[model samples]
Target: MSHQSGHQHHIWVQSHHPVKLEPKLPQPLPKEPTFYYFAYGSCMCPVDLKRSLGENTHHYVIGPSILQGYRLGFYVYSPTRKCGVLDIVPDPKASVKGVLYQLPWRLSEYLDKREGVAQGLYRHELVNIHCQDQVYQDVRTYIVVDKLAEEAAPNDWYFNVVLRGAVTCGLPEEYCWHLFNHMYNLQQRNQERQLRESA
Candidate 1:
């Protein structure tokens, strides 16, 4: 008898199967030392902040906040960006609206580097921030080391980024409009000056 006839034969088939995997959930941020930061400029944009901080910053954002006793100004010229950047100036009657963050302490050095702290382009200023019916004290922000005598216009790139950050981070609609007008007026003035100089 044939060897196959000694026992009942069984056929085994193998088939490729697709796996059903559960969607991955975002991991919670690691517990670590953190610091409160108030961003009034390009840093207000999480997209921009991520570029420097080397990580996503959206999770760190608290929300739109008010910096009382201060006003926003474009008093610093960035040679790197080739435009004027925002700075906070003391003004008792004015308030600056900006994004607040509770960033990991590890990001402090990166933020400092981005702010040009070592180069003295900006220096840290400790202040209070009001957000969501709470006052956060001793929050760190940056100010120009040497402010220009007159405000300077931001380039189109800077202008767009500032406005994008303001809107994306949910700053007040009125404040966003005011910011837009302020930048536009400065740009108009700059264009007129250029035309006159070239003529």
Candidate 2:
């Protein structure tokens, strides 16, 4: 698929290749701490993820998760309490595929901060979000709460980052098309609702 600059953006996350910390954090144990990052709304592109996980992060591009009936919602940009997660009903038949990254202990710390993993905003959980016979083993991932961003819909520029990254992650053409269609519809609905609430 050709790269286009619009609703869907294309960001390249560089690999700085930083050294991993030998001594992990005392509280967040890494004894069997495996990193499993879910990339549904964004975080799909390896390069972008690489920036967060560094070059040594191991990942499996498994996705199309049901989100367990949870929908993708936007919070205030990032590093904000306004961030929220949303509800999207799950269809056992329909799969929302994305990427899953498994990083080392040191890398996880960096992501923890980036994703607000410490403030109890994003909780780490293990899930089996895959199609066919594929299943992730002991994959730990963090999830954001939808209600936080319920009122703060992401702006076009921020959402574009997700769109662009998803495109580069090798999402199937059909799925990519669906994303475009869904994003448009969601944008319109969000606007109308905002107007009504204000009125």
lDDT for position 63 in model 2 = 43
Worst 10 residues of 2 by lDDT: 10-19
Q: Give the Cα error of residue 56 in candidate 1, in Å.
A: 0.5
lDDT of 1 by residue, 10-51 (tens): 211111221221124243355468999999899889999999
Q: Lowest summed lDDT over 10 consecutive residues: which window, candidate 1?
A: 11-20
lDDT of 2 at 173: 74
**CA lDDT, candidate 2, residue 85:** 28
Tell me the tens digit of each residue's lDDT in model 2 across 125-166.
Answer: 566655445666555555654434243455564456566766
- Show where candidate 1 strays beyond 4 Å: 1-30
